[model samples]
Target chain A: MKPRGWKELNPGAVITEAGSARKFKTGSWRSFKPVWIEENCIQCMMCWIYCPDMAITAKDGKRGEFNYYFCKGCGICALECPGKKGKKAIVMEEEGQ
Target chain B: MSASRVVAVTGNESVAEALRQVNPDVSAAYPITPATDIMQRFTHYVSNGKVKTEMILVESEHSAMSACIGASAAGGRVMTATSSQGLALMWEELFIASGYRLPIVMSLVNRALSAPINIHCDHSDGMGARDCGWIQLWSENAQEAYDNTIQAFRIAENMDIRLPAMVCMDGFIISHSIERMEYLDDDAVRNYVGDFKQLYPLLDIAHPVSYGPLILSDYYMEYKRAHAEVMSKVKHVVLDAASEFERISGRKYGLFEDYRLDDAEIGLVVLNSAAGTSKDVVDAFRDRGIKAGLLKPRLFRPFPYEEVGEALKHLKAVCVLDRADASGASYGPLFMEIASSVSPYSPRPVLLNKIYGLGGRDYLPGHAESVLSELAEVAATGKVRTFKEYIGVRE
Candidate 1:
């Protein structure tokens, strides 16, 4: 993005509008991505409660997929996921793979 | 103008009187030598209900400045006081306060930094923070110190130039020595400084604003550029405030004060209390038929370069004295500034630098006489001697 010139910047770099933090995308910082396997899932909503970035998408009390735009790939969701036996619902994978 | 009382008090007492009259909303301070008296006296007013200021006695100078930043962001008139090491300790917060555009005022009692473990008057402390984006007003004595303290409020709080300012006075010399000064009535000072109008105050909850936000590389330079642009407007604001202050108290001020410099062939540039001593020597040289004058810079940061250049360009020889040494740079800070300002003019004056009075050594009148004599000789012969030399140091 072409940066704004000095004249356009606000005095003291103050952000006048609230919640401007949403404009920045932090997901690109991740080296690993969280992969959700719905086949082994038991919709416990634990990932939603454990996700630090609020990147877990949900609707009407049901667990959904990850919002990659904001997720940092912390693997917290995969760690918190309670799935059947040795098969976890959420797993971490290298971003490129 | 209202009636003001004449009082004999030390610089710290006079500054405390000014703070008492203006009665800022918050003052967060930590005690240090030479400047401890200013804050200590102010706290008495806070205790006796002489002024309604919230005094936060912090653990260190760093925390004092931190509390000042928080209080100022919350939209209150804030002030503080410190000396040498204390000022050094608050170094990071100095940039933060100015960068955030907080109109905080500080009374900087100039003292030497530690290492020799000294507590004495010198310009090292204030000179060290010269580039921190705060407006610096140098005062010659108790009277000027008190006047500058009162004027800093109006200048810093100016909406067009919302930057922090420091009113600097020599430690022990002006800070501790008793001098006679005038005090404007409390009502006059109140009416003069008026009220602080906060810009994007954090306390204005209905209209939310975030300060010191995380600005990445893409926008950080632009923000700094904008900050530099604001400083370009401070010179005008300082003058306007001085004029307003003149109305309340009949003392006039300017970016720099010229003493007998009109058509002067020999000149000297000095700062703070040394200027007071240099003026008498200038008169002595005048009596001896050597055309001598002096220029004492009142506004050091965002220096009045063009005006200074114009003032010194006519002289055949000019000497710049620095109370603090810019070690390894060879030339003193003031000399470098004067050299740069006058670089463009044809027939530029012969500029010399003399490092003097470090660690509170006495600035004697004889020292000024010798420097002026050198200027006289260089002007007459049109030849140069050593360009930079340290004065008052034992060989």
Candidate 2:
């Protein structure tokens, strides 16, 4: 209903150039976040390689973990992964997109 | 990288092959000359079922981008291509693509933006879209054309990087040139690009999510704030994709690249196919003991501000060459962005704006010599100018 902008609460946007912080445009969470299904992931490591932000993570020794720290929540992996649908292991959820 | 082995696909065909590589679900287009060939290739793919995607032929470029936003919102990988007046027509939907953060990837043929009207190549068409919040990339050749299209999808589709991108290549030259290009095999491209699953598909009847909701002033600034935040994702996306594209294509590149500039004191900023010409000129300059080098722009829209500024930081004279004129401004749009990038820094190098190749005017060897001569003058004068003479123009 309203536009997204900078806030004291969120990390907000980065100051690309010099000068004081400009007015906030929108709060991020407007984008989307991706959720991963642990059981279905075969840990092919494709998500990490193809991830533009390198947002995917691996578990300690066990492997197959995604920190989702910087994940915009694009479901490319979940949708393309063999485990999708009845066995969708990685699903996209709405967050600070 | 060896230029001899380069493939000779037209700019439009590059878009068609790029569509196959990017692998979108819904493709639409309203063709213009030079750019029409792009939709042609896409049509063949759709008919042959090689791409396995919907090829929607729209009535106009405006509807093409709007339909793209809808398709992207509905969670389909989408693509389109246009040039000159067609791009001018799509201006409104261009902003809509960014506002909705649809991450739509379109191809611009880098034709001269019309007034007196020319079908030839220039930055006017692409520069007009500068403030639209889409990532812009210019290709030196058809390979970069193919390469940027795939990386554009990777950049636009990333959540933090969910903005649109216009992968620009010269309309007639690179678009029409027939060279030997190593086309990426479908499976390998599929493996490299993976699939574009939408962040949250708007069409899912069960899970209703918001997209381009009405934004009052309060919230409007915030989404724009996030838009700024999302561009940071570009540094990562470009680097990551460039690395892989290089591995496959074997010609490594960055957002902005320096040719013969490693130790040169003179900097010439340029974009598109002109970079190839500039490289030869730089060699001739070096033979004459003039250290003039080139700062070729790879990514125009995101502006690649930091890389460009840093590259020119050590130069004695930084000549900003613009292919498109910005009417009343200091010079062309690219020159302005360069000047502003180094605006705050003191003892800044000199910036000279040289407008060349309007209405498809050619920048030949004699023109290159004159450009270098002017650089010699600026290096000797130390005066910072917002404008300079047009190179190789007829009286």
Superposed model 2: Cα runs more than 4 Å off: A1-97, B1-7, B381-386
lDDT agreement of model 2 with the native: 0.75
Query: Best lDDT goes to which candidate?
Result: 1
TM-score of chain A of each: 0.87, 0.52
* Candidate 1 residue-pair clash tally: 0
Residue pair clashes in candidate 1: none
lDDT of 2 by residue, B60-106 (tens): 98999889988988889888889999999999989888767777888
Off by over 4 Å in 1: A39-46, A82-87
lDDT per residue for candidate 1 within B222-316, as digits (tens), equals 88888888999989998999998888899999999999999799999999999999999999889988889999999998788998998889899
Q: DockQ for each candidate?
A: 0.83, 0.05
What's model 1's lDDT at B244? 85
Residue B358, candidate 1: how far off, in angstroms? 0.3
**Local accuracy of candidate 2 as per-residue lDDT tens digits, A1-97:** 4533354312212222332222333223226666777788766666666665546665553335565445555667666666634686667766634
Q: What lDDT score goes with residue B35 in model 1?
A: 99
